[model samples]
Target: MKEFLTDPHQIERESMRIIQGHLQLDWTEQELKIVERCIHTSGDPSLEPVIRIHSQAIEAGLEALKRGALVITDVEMVRAGIAKKQLAQLGSTVECFLSDFQVAAQAAEWGITRSMAALRMNKERLKGAIVAIGNAPTALLEVLELAKDPQTRPALIVGIPVGFVGAKESKDLLWEEHQELPSITILGNRGGSPLAATCVNALIYLAVKREI
Candidate 1:
């Protein structure tokens, strides 16, 4: 990683080479050089490397906040309560809320997309419906309603757990609360998290790009 960071140009060249070699795609020497150069000048080492967020980090962040310390948490921490706990521990009068609203919003958007596709039977004709459960019962209901129609049903149902809160309620909502729609042929909960929703959104983007 350090070597790649220091010589990003080399990294890019190596990456392109690997990609081209594996895919049997031809690339001009000049194009490869250009890509390498672009990689090198992209940024400086002092800039922080991206990190995946996790629950432990959130706990740490919460602990920090409790200490009345100025807290800086990564995206993963935002969803976790570490920063909040830290603040509470310190007795600091400061009130702060860490949120990965971007991620949440993205999930919501994907839910909307899924709902739309399910409603229109778009997935049946195009890709296929794969329903994934989320943390929010209300949100799940919304998605289900959107997907419901006379002719189309979801091909798959994924029950992905979202974070620590609302898991049971969300599950109940998906399983027991809502009326089963005829359009949904498959139903299975993945028991993961909202992370699955994020992944689904990313998959959509990839699919679109691949088409383009």
Candidate 2:
């Protein structure tokens, strides 16, 4: 699979092709316009063109899904009972689900940075300290699960955390849960958040770009 940073339009086009190839879905012109608007507003071409939703995020997600837009949403959105049933009814129409684990992971990474910053008593110095300590893998898994489609098999699973209660366990659970899938790529206990996020983002960028 090819991976590179590209413009939003390019990513959107490639994503459209990938979804069509994998799921046999087509985007209406209006749907494409919505995506373009989102991309334009976001102003980050590298940004994944996901229809994100919280509780209220579902309306937008549903609209996007109907229009052939790829969705990346949390479990709460489904649990809220807003559009979960309808979304599932789409039948292979929705492309991805970013579980709580994914959200927690991303949050944990930020928490770690924040914690380290507090410990150092300086936000500006945190990056250097984090770099000196190396990347944490446990943090990476959380974020990945958040961004990854639990339905689509993952190629790498990196678990990098220092010493947080339940952090390692969570990653372990993720690895165990998906162990049967050979597409998984897992990093050992030594992996760090920075590395994990970078790697995961790269993989996701490739996944969206290649339409995997």
Q: What is the TM-score of each candidate against the true structure?
A: 0.26, 0.24
RMSD of 1: 18.7
lDDT of 1 by residue, 1-212 (tens): 35334575666556645444433223344222322222232222211121112213223333333344332111232224222332344543221121423444544667643323232332232122334333433334544554565333433333334345555455555556444521111122222333333322222223223221
Q: RMSD (Cα, Å) of candidate 2?
A: 16.3
Model 2 per-residue lDDT tens digits across residues 43-161: 43332322211222223323333443332211222123223344344431221222423444544666753222222222221111111111333333433443244433222222334
Local distance difference test, per candidate?
0.33, 0.32
